[model samples]
Target chain A: MDKSLQKTEQEEIESKRKVYREAKEQTRKNARRLRFDESNPQPKKDSVDSPRKRFYRQRAHSNPFSDHRLDYPKSPESMDWSKYYPQYHDKESNNMLQDVEIADIGCGYGGLLINLSKEFPKTLCLGMEIRVQVTQYVEDRIIALREQNKSKDINYQNIAVIRGNAMKFLPNFFKKSQLSKMFFCFPDPHFKQRKHKARIITNTLLSEYAYALKVGGIIYTITDVEDLHNWMVEHLTEHPLFERLDKQWEDQDKCVEIMYNSTEEGQKVERNKGDKFIACFRRLPDPEI
Target chain B: MKHPYQNIVSTSTHLFVSVQNHLQAFDVEGNLVGSWKDTIGHEDLLKKQQLEKIEKLNQEPEIKRAENNKKVKIPKIPTPGPGAPTIYNYIRDLELTHDNKYLIGITDSDKSIIIFEINLNEDNCLKLIKRQTFPKRPCSISIADDNSTVIIGDKFGDVYKIPIIGENVPEKDLKPILGHVSLLTDVLITEHNGKQYILSSDRDEHIKVSNYPITYVVKHWLFGHDEFISSMVQFDFDRELLVTGGGDDYIYLWNWYGNKLLSKYPLRDLIEPLLDESHLPPERFLHEDSPKEISVVKMITMDKFVVVLFQKVNGLLVLEIKDETLHLVELFPLDYPLIDISAGGDKIFGLSEDKIITQFTFNGKLTIDDKEFKGMIENNPCEVQSKEEFYPLYTMNTLRKRSEH
Candidate 1:
């Protein structure tokens, strides 16, 4: 029995080392593929491939309060969206064809952006993720999809991903009432009593969301945690600028159906047979005092 | 032991200073008129009283032995270290109502807003009228122009509006009108063309100007600073010109109403010689050999000049505004570091690190005044026993964001 136990321990350590070696090899290959230099200025349309998710796995949670070093425009006017959407750039005018009207906050794995691209083909949709590796994965995934569908009519030119802390300075990247739809799908649920302030949805963050959304703009939220869902519902219902949409409104909305099944977290919940709760709120006109 | 006055406010008839947990008011002649102390040690006193009662009832000796045995079996949990969160019961922010009828202060111990009715004739000038507690500690306070509402910004990035004189509403009934996800540094309520607006700055280098009362309606954001804003003051001569300084290397002058950047006055050339080793970044970044940083501690405007103080620096920078531009006029050096400053009438009173008040007058040139309030107002004794018991004398640098996960 003692000999068998020793042999099993040795095997476990060997297996762990093998996993680490595989991850390191995958990282090297990914770096080589993403390198852009004078020799390889642009890749052939069919050569681009989707990045593997196993090579880009990161921790599920990130603290919203910490000052993560991020690159963001000083204001909406200073933001040059042409680089993010090169196909839509107008060379004569030195500007993009349209502004980003849809935002997916904490868009993990590019699942929802992929689904939303087809639903709102004309609208420019952007995903904002805080984690470094996760954001790069989404960018690679979008690039691969766009290259793969170059011959199709509905090319994936309208979707883009950026690394940003939306909680701190959403106004810095977008003008007043610039977004028509904002998604908060499966955000980090800071569960500690003292950490409730770090939760993505709160009374204060709602005001910023309201500022970015035009009148009648919709904010869609879904989560697997019932407690977080209740907290989001309570705060959104209390904010004067946001009015909760009823069940009938949720039933008729096509985006709600897409949101329920698109994200990676939602699929994980579906596999585990867990409950999913969704709430939608509409931005109201400012009151005259 | 010397205790620096953390806060000093001057009114027309009296001067008030907060030392540790004590708030003392003095008349123009430097006579201590009235005083108030925070209820800091009441919990310890109650625990002592309860233990004495238990000791008296346990004279049987059998119960005592059993208790001793249980104590021996269970080890006591160690006390938290310096980095742990501790409840400090001292005045964090103080402001006077527009009418000057009441003095408002927020206590850090209980997170309560205390209102005092100022009566000079009575022996006890400060009458504790109302004490209302909130969910978070209030970091900055501002009274509305109409004097009916009190706007408080807390460390949790929420701005709440409470009535100066109104019914005692429960804590649950109170709600914040606006908020930021980052920590709030300063909040101000200013008027343009008879319309009130709220200007709030956060640690994320954002200064939002929103419509007052209807605070849900955001007007615009002033977005030039790459560092957290530590202080913001409106130009006395031109309300449209907003002056802001913070953890950055420069101060910005803005035409807030028009959303234009008028000027950016760099401070590194002026303050680099004054930076010492103590001005280095917090311990986490020591390995990087990063350069020292400067944070603007306090700023006040007088006539056409703005008096600015940097954290732990033993000097003051006076800037003259010309053509909507900020030009450094003079740097008045001091013997000791300055803690806080207040402007009263034509005189500027500075509280230094040595626990004394230095007066300065600005006619055509800045000169020190001969008047002294050392023996009278600075003689009050505090109960601090050791260096660890004293509260922090400077906290503006803590507003700088750290690169941590």
Candidate 2:
């Protein structure tokens, strides 16, 4: 088993090395072309073409304007993590009950993740996104934040990003009573009238959230769409193992301040008084009956 | 043979002595062409704007009496519009689209800008057509002439040429144009003597001017600060001269082509009064007790004057350098820090620290026709500037490097 694990690690290393080489070479060519343009002004064309060739690799790889997408050519199958766990700095540091260790679901593009991490530096933060492109995006975001942390002592080891479906892989990864806080700031509303149930925050999903969170663990929901907000409230409020916090709790809740100021979504909502209704629910102990 | 601003001038300003024939062609939008620029009394700008609005609403003129304090909600206004820019904050850095058109903004929810074309169009129209998204956070963005390629500069020194093709697809290799190790604050495709150049500035005290293979380091060891270089701008009239504002509380004017040294404009005067009687941060401030945190310098204009809107004071200061002298002019003050400023034609637009735009003229008469803006006391009668940190416990060093680079 050890040997196989080593072999798998080596394969991962090789794959990343190849990707780095491609990125480096691409960087060099791009630098050259950019420099060329600086010296000689060139008229822009209609397309921001992607130069995808591995040094003249071909027309097949080229994206005329660079935004072309297609399915992965099989065996380029993306990696999946299940029954996976990371080495935490310490064990006594389980942040579930005492502090908020949040998992921002569907952290698209990443603005929300960045803001939340900064606002609640003490809160253990994790971002989950299913889109492979945006997952890599969160990776870069973590890297940049880590870079900016150099001059200040703001430690964000508490923060991380993982690629997986929160719905599919929650049980395989985190055991029950793990996360203290869960945020569904903004999800793909799937406003398609028929696909209304396809939305991320659902009653079944609330159960999943209940499973992952410890007793007293809180779930925070916010959305600009009134329909989605009502839907979220309806689902979570009806869940048996949950109870609502009071206005004082809402006001004194650090998470409330975090919610109010942290995300670009927060800023937009605040600006328009845009019905960005927020609701917080706490997980209750399972019924003895 | 020698000029004081030669040190920071990337392209010197062709200085303007007085106002010229102002074009009355357009006022921001082409349709709102009321009174473009017929050198009327200073009040004409806002007054004419109001009269035009009255005409648009077809409201009967009010009797000759006192103006009402009750204001109408001008939807196309100083209020939130459909084009109200959605700024993305990735903790430390900021990214705004070329315009709040399609996908107005994108950030990693942290400090990274991923490339996404929003229809971030700041237009009056509600329809949006966001064509594509890139996985890079470009700190600065500008479009090429054909509008096909948008040049995006990231804080990590990656410059990308994003193709604005109509469709978003997967097969394309999106990453292009990469260099530098620091965040780029602003970028401009400059034209000088029929030559083209890309001038980029960062938190570093240098403004890089390049034409690809040939790159000119306009201001290398700008000796002013020990902190980040926040921004740089050319005096509109000067093509070879430019000014840079940094955390060091000093604005620099450099000579672009000649790479000559220039004088420094210390910003101590503007905030010195505010910093009076202050509790000190670990860093140094002009006044003994003043908190020495790195105050950010926002926008600089070419007329040898920089308008700095800092956190402590959200007001505008006119930093002018004329005849080899530097002066700070206080145009007006805002309730909060000024984040961004944009000027087109003679009208000026400023965004406050609160993310709202206060649209008005930087230069206006004491009264708008009848309502007089009684000149504020340089030293207000009853109020005393506080000596405490405006934002207690909030460290400006949060913008500085923290650790894991």
| Top TM-score hit | 1
Candidate lDDT (C-alpha), each: 0.82, 0.47
Score candidate 1 by TM-score against the native.
0.87
The complex in candidate 2 yields a DockQ of 0.02
Candidate 2 docking band: incorrect
| Candidate 2 structure quality by residue, lDDT tens digits, B379-405 | 111222452312122223434432221
lDDT (Cα, 0-100) at B324 in candidate 2: 46
| Candidate 2 lDDT score relative to the true structure | 0.47
What fraction of the genuine interface contacts, i.e. the true contacts, does candidate 2 reproduce?
0.00
The deviation in Å at residue A219 for candidate 2 is: 56
lDDT of 1 by residue, B1-405 (tens): 566678877775677788777888877567888889887543543454466456655654677868667432332234569898765567887788867778888887767788888898899799888887777878888888888878889888889988877666787687888889878899999889989989999888899998898887788899899889988898666799899999999989999888899999999988989989889987877767687899998898888888998999978899999998999898888877888887776777788656467777876457888877755445566745566766788887778777754
